[model samples]
Every structure is written in C-alpha cells, then in structure tokens.
Target chain A: MTGDGVLAQALRYLNDPLSWTAPGGILDLTGQHLVMSVLAALLAAAVALPLGAWLGHAGRGAAVVVALSNTSRALPTLAVILLLATAGLFGDTATVLAAALFAVPVLLVGAYEGVRGADPAARDAARGLGMPGGRVLWQVELPLAVPLLAAGVRTAVVQVVATVPLAALAGGGGLGHVIAFGMGTQRYGQVLAGGLLVAALCLVVDGLLALAQRFAVPRPLRARAAATAAR
Target chain B: MPGNPWFSLEWVRANADVLATRSWQHLLLTLEAVAIAAAVAVPLALLVGRRRRAAGAVVGTASVLYTVPSLALFAVLAPLLGIGRTPVLVGLVVYALLVILRQTLAGLQSVDPAALDAARGLGYGPAQVTLRVQLPAALPAVVSGLRLATVTTVALVTVGVVVGYGGLGQLMFEGFRNNFHRAEITTATLACLLMALVLDTLLWAAGRAATPWLRGRADGGRRAGHGQPARASVRAGTGTDLGADGRGEAA
Candidate 1:
C-alpha cells in the first residue's frame, strides 16, 4: 500500500533513524521537554508544597487556597510564556518559569486539600499521644497526605510535560520545535510526528506517576481509598 | 529615547479594530467549543450515570484525550482538518469534554437517592425523574463544570494562534514576533485573563440564579440548625472541590 497519508507519512518520519539521533532531533527535543517539565515541577513543588501543607496543617487559609486554585484556571499558559519572554527572559528560562506558574496552583491545592482532608481522628490521636506539632505534621499528617500529594505532583508533571511544547512558539527548544518548524514549512508529516511524540511522552509520564501514586500510599490507606471509591 | 511602555495607550488606539475583532473571536470560539462540549457531554454523562464500569471507561478515555497537550492536539488535527478554526474548535471541545463529563456524572450521582425513590413512588417515569429531579439537583456540579470549562477554553483559545484561529492568542503571538512588543503582548495577555475572569463570574452568578434553593439557604437560613449550616457550606465549596476533581482527572 502507498504511504502518502498523514499518519503514514508521520510514521515514516518516526521510522527514520536520523529523526532520533540528529542534532535537535526527536531524542534531543524529548530530553529538553523532560528537563523543562521536571525542573518546573520541582520548582513549583518546592514553593507550593511547604506553604500549602503548612496552611493546611494550621487549618487556615482555606479561602485563599480555594481562590488561588480558581484564579489559576484562568491564567493562559501561552500568554504566560509570551509575557515572560517579553519581560526579557528567553529560551528555556521563560518556558520553565511560565510552566512553573501554571503548575503551582494544582500542587498547592493538592497539598492543602491532602493535608486538611487527613483523618481528624488520626490527627487528634497523634496529638493526644503527646506528639509535638512538628512531629505530628511529619509522622502522622505527612504520611496520610501522601496519596493526594502524589496525585497533585502527577497532575502538575503531566500538565508541565504537555505544556512544554508551547515553548516552541516562543523560540524555545522542545518536541514542540519539530511541530513548529513543520507548521512554518508546511510539512504536515513532521508536525504529526512531533505531536505523536509529545502525546506519547505525556501518557508515559502520567502512567508512571499513577503507579507511583498508588505505591506511595500506605497499604491500609490504599484499601480505604478503594473502599470509599467503591461505595 | 526611552523604550515603549508595557501598556501604551497609543498602541491600543492604533490597533483598536484588530484588538476588538480578536477579542470577539476569542469569546465566540470559547462559547462555540463549550456549547458543543456541553451538549455532547451531558447526554453521554446521563447515559453512563450510575454505571460504574461504563463511567470508568468513558471518563478514562476522556482523561487520556485531556492529557494530550493543547498545542499537540492542534498540530495533530491540523493535518486532518487542514489548519483553521475547525482544528482549534475540535481541540477545545476535546479538552472541555473530560471536565464537563466528569462533573456531569458527579452531579448526577450526587442526586439524593431518596429523591429518586420518591419520584419513582410518585409514578414518575425514568425520563421524568431524570428531567425533573435529577437534572435540577445536579445543576450545581454541572454548572461548576461549565465554569471551569469556559475559563479553560478562554485560555486554550489563545493557543489556537498555532492554527491561525487563536483569537487573542494571535495578538499575543504577534506581539512576541514583532520584536517582543511589550505593549501588544501585555495587552493581549491581560485581555485573556480579564475575559476568563468575567466569564467565570458570570457563570457563577448564573449557577446561583439557577439554584434558588441554594441562595435561599445561604441568605435566609442563617439560624437553620447545624445540619443546614453544614450542607450550605458544602454547597458553597462545591465549585472548588469539583475544580480540583476535574484537574486531578484531567492530568
């Protein structure tokens, strides 16, 4: 069968070894994508987690958390990147900064909700057992909050990974570069191939994170979550 | 001479027509995508309601679709749809589906079982029960979903510049392409944020107006007992709770 269709052509592009190993090829772009996603996620987690967890443990700032999460949904990632680029940051720096901003609210919300939603009985029992505030947060609350924390990171990472492709629009490097280059040159096949690569990367990252989320929870907590889900 | 300011009134005046056109296109695209998504997702949600396996499968697929980056979705569709409003519109609908579907399902599931039973005992057919009891009760969650979807679509519409239909996105990108025109980029970006805020507020108001019972409790039931107070708080918190839920599944 002739291979003139977009999918076939895209597959052909994917099949080419040069596409993987050449300078600025798929592998190179994929690495850039992963690096941006990971760095952005780490930056977001570093800032959002401690603040969110502290606020949640204190049982304060519920309204702030709620409002922040709501407003975050309205911030466009593309606009964010362009705004940053215009502000003098360029290349991967702007991409990561924009992505971290995009990733922050979910992580913060997740951290807050996870810690706050921890079992009150468990927290009280730990308190009653003469545990200090810091100890309670570390030993009891943090462990219980693991599932939601993991889920939050997973969401943030997937979002970052997905969004890093937009860096191409700002003249940054990533899998999006291939797609952007193709679009500019009218090479539909390359665009499709790049799109496929990005999509595949997102799925793989998400799946791995889902597994991590499952394994991060204590067995008892996992069972309880399953039971609640079932009910 | 000093550089151009980030918010130059001159630039706004110079490009007033294009800015207005782009902003209108942005709003129109968001509305079309969200309207189509709601029409499809509501029916799909109702059909899959209370069916554990089917809901899982349908939502699972939608979530996978959601995981695909907006830019990639546009790129993939461009080859098939030939790069225009259609691909961008299709991408927006796909992005909105998971959010709307999951919330719609959650809303349907949240309908009090007792209410359903009462409707049944009153000789209401399944259709009537769904239309009269379930839909009304589930309105809050559905509306929350719409709010999230609309805001998200407003943002995603900016990404449509890739396919040449990104509404305000075109302005933002153009601002960048034009030697990083600070005024143009800042203006378009702020416009998107403003549009999203306005749309979200409008939807929240509409949700409240649609659910008069919720307003009645919040406004007039200040001393309406412990259970009433708790329930009122839960209803008030439903939007954010559902927002978190949608984002969780979206990833």
Candidate 2:
C-alpha cells in the first residue's frame, strides 16, 4: 500500500471522493453508460425478439439466423460507431444505433434457438387440448424458450455495456470518457482506474442478468434445469 | 454532391496502398493472436483435461478476462507494455483465450469413450491414446473454437487503436478525426466486415476438409440429429453442446 506502483495509484484514484463527485465524475459517467447501454438493448430486443420468435415458431430461416450470428461477431463495434457517426448521425444517436446493431444478432439467435428448442411433446399436448396454433405458440413454446431467451439477452446486454466505452472515441458520453481523458493526458493511474470501473460494471451487469436468467424460467423448467445440472 | 459522400471511388483509388497496408496489418495481427491463443489454450486444456474443479477454475478466470472491454484491457496493458503492438497482441490473445479454451476442452471431452477404450485395449499408453485416438476425434470442435476465436480477434484488433495499433480501426479513427471522412470510414468498415466473412468461410472449408467422415454423416439421417443441436446451442450462447452431445452419445 505504501508503494507508488500503478496499481496502488489506481486504487488511490478510485478511492478519492473527487473522482466520484466531480463535474464528470465516475457516478455521472456510469449513469450515461448505463442509459446508453439499456436504451440500445431495448431497441435491439424490440426488433430481434419478435422476429426471432416468429421465425423460430414457423421453423423457418434457421440457416439465416446462424449466418447472422456468425457474421455479427465479426463486426467491430469501433468500426460501426465510426461509420454511423461519420455518416452524418449525431454523436449519441450514432452510439446508440451502433450498440443496438451489435446487440441484435445475439438477441435474435437467442430467441430463435430458445423457441425452436422448445419441447415438441408439450406443443403436441397443447394442440391435442384444442389449443390453436397461435395459442400453442403463446402457451407452450414461448414459456419453454424463456431460459435461452434470457441467456441471450444477458449476453447481449453485457456485450453492449462493454462496447459502449467505444462511444467515447466517437465523441459520445460514457465511462469511456474517463479512459479517453486519461489516455489523452498519459495518466496511467487514471486510465487503469477507468478500465477497472468499466470491467467492474460489466461483471456486475452480467451477474445480475445471470440471476435474472435463472429466475425468468418457469418454475418447472427451472427445476428441470437444476436437475440436469445436478446429474 | 452536398458535402463528401459516404463512399467515393476516387478516394478508394487514391488510398489503395494505405488500405492494403492496413488490411494486411489487420489480418496479420488477427492470425498471430489466434495462433498464439490456440497454442496456449490447447495445451492448457489438455493439462486440465477431465478435471472438473480445475476446468471450472480456469474457465471462470478466463470468462472474467473475457468480460473486460477490449479498450479497457488495452488501457490497462499500455501502462505496463508501453503503447504499441505488443500490448494489443497480448490483449487480443487474452480475449481469444476464453473462447478457444472452452472449445478445446469441450472438444477433448467430446471424444468417444469407446475410441479411448479401443486405443487402450491395443496396448496404447495414456499419452498415445490422447494423441492418436482423442485428438483427431476432437479436431472438429477445436477447429470450431479456432473459427470463433479468429473472428472475434479480427473484430477486436480494431480496439487496439487505443494503443495506436488498431489495424483498420486506425483508419476508422483517422476518418472521424479528419472531419468525418466518409469514404475513408466506409471503406475501412466494409473491409473489416468483408475480412471477417472471408476468413470464416475459409475456416469452415478447412474444417470440412479436415473431417471427411463428417461428410459421410452429412449424407445420413443422423446428420440432422447431430449437427443441428450443437449449432443451435453455440448460436444460443450456451456453447456447452459439444460436451453434452458426447455425454449423450455415451449414455
């Protein structure tokens, strides 16, 4: 603790009250980061969820879903942000749009796989019980697909949160502003502190979503998942 | 036409040399990172083979590393390594580790138990069984992991711009800094996307070539039952289907 190592300095920087309550303090930046990430995720889910679910239910376009998921992984967030921002979009709008575009493939693939992987037996039972096709999809398939769908959302949210930092490079607001500022000034301690903050945020968000994923599944499905894990 | 257009053939024609250099750098950096990651991850996976506690610990630590943003990781490393390709390379390798390690372990675990038994019955030693029997069988999954890692590395190499080593990302950054040079940004971005797709197709073809037996299975009914679930699970984000499928086959 006495040594003036980079880690020690970073720890000191994080501990100071000034870092938390300054004009663009950690708290302020964190709020910006979360807002952008959440908005982008919601935007992505609105489009991806319904489309993926409908496609999965219809048992169509599985190949396209797989292809999109693979291709999206290769689309750099930095490139996307730069493209949109330079294409005449406003800074915050560009950031949100890029993040939403990055999140879509994961959500789409998740919803598609979730609904497609639903138990055929349950669907058959619902059909036999005089449920219409639409009712069977609503009552049987969607519920069964909840776990995987939540998992996808969890992954997408974490990824978007992680990538939001790149928005700073494009003149947008976020915790990335802290890192970008540190980099500009060659302040290693501040840079490390910013990195730590972003990493911590990502882990916390991921952990919360992981818990949500666990709880979102129907009780019976949760029990079955637990049983499978136990086995 | 009302300011600079999104794309311009003249700009691309003039900057062709710069574009090629950046594209090559991007490709080289991606290949190096993934190759190094595969080298490290495969050995680590083999060392931790079949050990549940060790595998859990290793993968848990890796997933934590994986969750850190690329820019943040580069920032943290820049202090230690000094701004350059080394830190970016190290960061890229770290990001690739979780995907590659998980895939390798999953692949090794997916090897048929009967194959191992057969190797042993023929007086094969443990090392021999691992090398001669298991490795070949797990090749498909390992290649699959490599494909994921490679694609991820290609995307991530752009973040290296934080340390001034972001390959095509540097061009994208430059475009933004230079009053939003539309053609420059569009060209670089498209190049990144094109590189990713082309690399993926190449890897997929290589995987197909390396595993000829799977082609035979492709022509059989079991193909639907075997391939679809694994592909679905991978895309769905669980990525645990290789091991699960092996266990199911054994059962």
Candidate 3:
C-alpha cells in the first residue's frame, strides 16, 4: 500500500464526517481552543488593563511596565504551565493562567503607551472644561486610545490561541491533542490537519479584529486621516 | 519530610551532569538559530529597505510566519524531517525572522535623509553611501533588534523538548515527567531565565560599545558618562518607517 503525503492525509482527515461529528471531533476541538484562548485573553486584560491605565493616568510606573514586559519575554509559557499543572491544578486552569501571564505584558504596554500618547491638547481641554481627572481619563484618554488598545488585545488573543496547544501536553484538550496524538501514532495527516486548523483560526481572528479596529477608531480621526491623504 | 523538591540540593547534585550538558545544548541551539536568522534577515531586510515599497509585504510575511503556532510548526516539519534538531532549528529560525527583519529594515531606513544627501554630495556611490552612511547610523536599531531576537530565541528553545531536542527544555520535560520534580523544574527555569538575561545584557553592552560614534555625537565631545546615549531614544519601527524623524534626536 502506498502512503499518502501529509497534505493528502490532512484532506482525508478533514473530509471525513466522523472527524467533525464524532466525540472529541474537529468542531469540538475548535470550540475548546477558542474557549481556552478567549478565557486567557479576558483574564489577562482584566489584570493588565486596570494597572496599565491607572499608571498612565497617574503618570507613574513606566519603569515597572518596561521591567515586567522585558522579564516576561525571557520566561517560557509552557514551563510555567507545566509547573502549575504538576502542582495538581486543573490542566485547563493552569494553561489559562499561564497564557494570561504571557498575554499581560503586551496588553499592559499597549494600554500605557496609548494613554500616554493621547493628545495633550485634548487632555488639557478636558481639564479646562472642569472635568475631574478620573472623568478625563475615562471620557477622553481611553476613547482616543481605543485603536492601540484594540491592537494590543488583538495581538494577545492571536498569541494565546496559538499557545493553547501546549496545554494538551498536560492532558488539557485542544487542537494540540490532534497534533500530539498524530505524532505519537505516526499519523502525519492528522498532524497537518491540526496545524492547518490552527493557522486558519489565527488568520480568521486577525482579519476580524482588523476589521473591528477600523470601526473602533474614532470616526473623526479616520476622516481626518483620509482628508489628509486626499490633500 | 523530603524538603522542597524544587530546591533540593541532593537532586541537583545527582543531575549535575545532565543539567550541564542540556544547558550547553540549549545555548548552542539558540546561537545557531539566531545566527541563521540574522544572516537571512539582514539581506532580506536590506533588499526590502531599499525598495521601501516592499516593506509592507516583507514585514507582513514575517509576521504571518511568526504567528504559526510553535508546536504546529514542529508538527508540520516532523512529517518531512522526522522530529529532531533540524526541524527545531528551522522552526526557531523562522520564529526569529520577524523581529530581526523588522529591526534591520527599520535600522536601514532610520538613517537621516540629510546624511544620505550629504554622502551623495561628497561623491559617494550608492553602495558606499549605504555602507558608510546608512549602515553606521542604523547600527543602534539593528543591534537593539538583534538583542531582542536573541533573548526571545533563547526563551523559545525550551519549547523544543517536544521535538526531542536536548536543550534546557529537556530538563524541563524530564522534571515534568517525573511527577514535577521541584529541583529539576526550578533549576531548569532559573537557568533558562538567567541565560536570557545575561545574554540580553551582553548584547546591550555590545551594542553600546560598537556604536561609539553615536555616543560621541550624543555627548557632543563631552566625556561619556553612565547615561544612555541620546540615540537610544530612537524608536525602532517594527513595520512602519519612522524615516528622518526617527533620527531627529540622533543629531
């Protein structure tokens, strides 16, 4: 019997009805991946957004933000996940927390930079209008900073999705299971299918977020940019 | 009580040989991957930087390549390469490409346009202007990019344990498999982080030392002190060309 190429094997696996509808099928795996990634992103944002924004508003902690982000780049997410999972936490929880930590530095950096880079004239004007400092931050700075904040979140989400497969190593379920199982059993096609699925998910999410960012940007800013280009 | 397994001196003493071997393997693997990445990225960045129009496409491609999941890349490569050092090395090289490529392009374009004009005025040829004027000015950004890429690659080497590469990740996997042996996990984690930090600091120092001219310009002939060079403020654009403005403070 002739062996199929990886591409051919992947197509066969993907085309099989059982692969989609059977227990722990492709659709199920996709759902697991999405849930795990979104959970991680939300968790990261919950922690990073407040601290970053507060720091930006107060004009303090830039050093801390820089230090945290730099140190984070030097730490491996999978190792953290492994350490946590081995400590008897639920595999998924460990993976989510680890991924959240990985996601934080980017989100925090984005929030801080965006707010810090907000238009000083606008900020002063808001203050001149007798707005409280907190009000100015929430009402003026954050709205103007939406584009950058969205970009950060978008990047973090895509990364978290991609990293979620590491969880499969600790017995947490995701598309990584398909890849790992294929590797163990020499099912090259299953591996390909899993990889293709992940890539497709990343592209789709990124495209959607790009579209969202376009809409998320303040309408006035977009019009001004367009008008400037026209001139 | 057996004390904290993670901090166990006995466990570390027992596994000293393996730990030392794996750390060396990890360092070598990271160096090889970064070297290959820099070689490819530099030429490609120079080509793309010259065109300006190709900047978007080049950066976009690298970003997309980077977004390919690490394990997924390994899985895809394993079918053809059979899960060993080759696949791991290739995966890491691709991973490092975006950061290095983006940095190089940014560095090349960061040269002051006035400087380029001055070089041309002095009868310098295109190649001479690029090498003498542009590259020298772009040094800080490029070196900064290289430093970031090296650190990132070092951390990522730990992921190669899945593909059977014996980096520090091998220790991580071993510790993981043996019911989370504390000493093993803690030691591997510390070693990996330390390597990344030490390598980053060394690269940072090397960058500073290599660009004495930048410091001279920043200091305006004042004896250099511990303060960072003013050129350090130039934001290395990852995709967008900051152009003349990026070097605004460099002067």
Candidate 4:
C-alpha cells in the first residue's frame, strides 16, 4: 500500500482503542497484557528475590546462583512462550510462566547484587548487634537491597510487557494482537504502530523504573559525572 | 534426562554437516547483530559522553528497546522488515543499547580525571582529549559493555528461529511444535547454555582485555590495548540486555 494508506491504517489503530480492547477484539491488547506482565514480574520477584538474597547473603553461593540464573536466562523467551503455549497454558498460565522464568535472572541478580554490594561494615555492625539471620536479612539486607530489588522487578515487568505479546499467537491477548493482525495482512503500518506502541510503553515503564530506582536506592552515582571525573 | 533421543549422537553425526551449517549460520547471525550493535553503540556513547544529559536519554531509550518480547517484536516487524535476520538484528541492536550506553557512560565515568586535565592542560583540543585521553580511560567500560552485549546477542539470537531460521532455538521450536518433548527441548536448552557460557567466558576475557582498568593494567600498555575499549565503543548490552539500564539513583 501507499504511504497514505499506511498512515491511515496506523491512525485508524491509534484512534480505535475500541478495536483493540472490545472484549477479545484485536487480541485483547489493553490492560490484559499489562496485568499479565505485572503479575509475571511479581512472580519472578517473589521467587528470584528471596532466593537471590539468600544466595547473596550466604556469601559463598552468590556465584552459583548468578551462574544458574545467567544460564537460565539463555533460554530463548519465545521458546519459553511456545513451550508453555503448547502445554495448554496460554492466556493466564502462559503469561505467568513466561514472567516467572524471564523475571528470575533480573530479580535474582538484582537482589543478590543489592545485598552483596551493601556496605560490608554495615552488615558487620548489624551482626555485631546480635541481629538474627532472618532479622538481618529482613531489616538490613532487604532494605539495603530494596532499590536493586525494585530495579530487577522493573526490568522483569518491562520484559513481560514486551514479551506477553507473543501470547497472542497462542490465543493470549495484548498488543501482540495488533501486531498479529497487521502481520496476517502484510500491513506494515499496523506492525509499525503496534511495535511503536509497545516500544513506547516499554520506555514509559523504563522511565518509571528509573524513577522508582532513584527513590528506592540511595543517591545514585552519576555516571556522567563519574565519567567526566575519571577522564 | 538432558539427553534427548532426537538429538542423539547418531542424529548429530549423521547430519554433522547440516548441524555445522546451522551452527555457522547461527554464529554469523549473532556476530552480525553484535558487530552492528558494537558499531552503533560505541560511537553513540561517545557522542553521548560528550553531552552527559543526552547519554541518559540514549540509555533510557535503549532500556525500553530491551523489553520488546522477542518473538512478538519480530512478528511486529515481520511485515516491515520481512523477517529472517533483519528484524532479529534490529531487535538485537535495540537490546544492545542499554549495555552500550551504560558501558560507554561507565567507561567515560571510569576515566581518570587527572589524566583528562593533563591532556587538556597540554593544549589538546576536544578531539585530541577525547581520542587520546577520555577514550582510553573509558576503554574498560566499553569493553565491559561489549562483553555483556556478546553474551546477550548469543542468547537472543535464538529468537530468530521463530521466523524460520535454523538456529538452536529452531530445534527447540520444532521439537515443541511436533511434540518431541523435553528430550528435544533439552538440546536447545543445552545449546543455548553452552553458547551463552562459552561466549560469556570469551567476552568476559575480552571485556578484561577491552577494559584495561578491569585488568588493572599499568602504564601505556593499558591505553594502546584493546582498541578504544567497548565501554567507550559498545553501546548495547542486553539479556538480550535483559533490560539492564541505569535504574537511576533518584528513588
């Protein structure tokens, strides 16, 4: 199609939110994907954060956990969705599994890094004060690592937002529906608009994550400043 | 359990040439994506480094790019780019952004301030200082970014299988679709892990090589080595950067 046609198609998509959200219309690209993504990220955080924290705090197991998570991350996400999809987990179940698997590395690593990188002296001081392992972790380690944990969760959420669209092919719903519709028809504009929206959403999520990080974490080391200073 | 019958030694040996072809194609696909990623990320980072505020913008944009769920992202682009390697590379490049930007910024950030001043005091222009002083300092970070990008690219390369490439993920996709089960899935999984691990180690070493600082090299040996360091050069690192970005310190 000509440029005008493409533009018109794209505009049509943007203007027609109803087309995307009208109850199973256009693959349920509305809040369904976001809900799925957030839930997936939370699931990832739930498992990875605690496990990562344990591994990180234990001091000796950090490498093992990191290695395992790192390896798990190698599992192609699309493959994960496909595998889960065929397992009859599309819709709710697929999103959950995909998010859980995808989120693990982020939360695990972030939590581990957050806690491990905390001021050792602080940990020492906490221990000296007779804090039990549970208390130290809950009160000290987790708090110190809150920002990192949040960062990891933010990453997982963003990933899930981007990823759950694949569920459309499996009968799950979200922005991927827009993409699939466009693809089925060889419509570039639809794809572009759909992709653009997804990217924009991800960017928004990333920006929010940055905001969360700034508040959750202490004063961030300004890399720009550091870069200049280092030079 | 990890060993599946479909990927039996017999099947592999019988089709060793075919497997090799797939391996090579996969390797080239990954490297092409990574090479393009390095090319784009490093220079962009340098530009960003020159203007600190913009670097954040670049990285911010990149992190968002990282989150585009691979297959769906590819499917979205399939109409425009026409699948195969094009969209995959596009996706991979976007993924590389956070890594490249962060490392570029990191490399610039990691530079020794005193050295920059010395270069400037010697009447060096902006160009000279960046080339002779700042770039060298940022090398380690650039290297680190490249290293991360390499591993990420390796992992994400499998996404290409969705659009009809025969990478390891293709095997997994086929296995899953045809009901070859975990045995078949295990091959793809192991292949991915092996590829990621091997590449990670190589790049980890390369990152050290890239970043003289990471290696704690002394004297002139540090600056001249590993080119400009990927920290200064590579702008993309992803899980496919796995959505790692400068989560900002404000929170």
Instruction: Count clashing residue pairs per candidate.
Output: 2, 0, 3, 37
TM-score of each: 0.93, 0.91, 0.90, 0.77
Error of 1 at B21 (Å): 0.6
lDDT of 2 by residue, B73-100 (tens): 8888877777789989999998777777
Candidate 4, residue B52: Cα displacement in angstroms equals 2.5
Query: Per-residue lDDT for B122-222 in model 1, tens only?
Result: 99998898899988887777787788789889988988887788999999899899888889988998898899988877877777777778765544222
lDDT of 2 at B206: 81
* Top lDDT model: 1
Worst 10 residues of 3 chain A by lDDT: A222-231
True contacts kept of 4: 0.28
Number of the predicted model whose DockQ against the real structure is largest: 1
Sort by lDDT, best first.
Answer: 1, 2, 3, 4
Expressed as tens digits, the lDDT of each residue in A71-188 for candidate 2 is: 6677888888888887778667899999898788778877887788788898888989999888878889999888767767877888889889988898888998888888888777
lDDT of 4 at B145: 64
TM-score of candidate 4 versus the correct structure, residues matched by position: 0.77
Interface RMSD of each: 3.3, 6.5, 7.4, 5.4
Q: Kindly report which residue stretches of model 3 are placed more than 4 angstroms away from their true locations once superposed.
A: A1-4, A223-231, B1-4, B216-251
User: lDDT of each prediction vs. the true structure?
Assistant: 0.80, 0.78, 0.73, 0.63
DockQ, each predicted model: 0.55, 0.46, 0.38, 0.32
Write model 1 residue lDDT over A143-181, tens digit each, in one string.
Answer: 988776777888888988988999999999989999999
Docking class of 1: medium
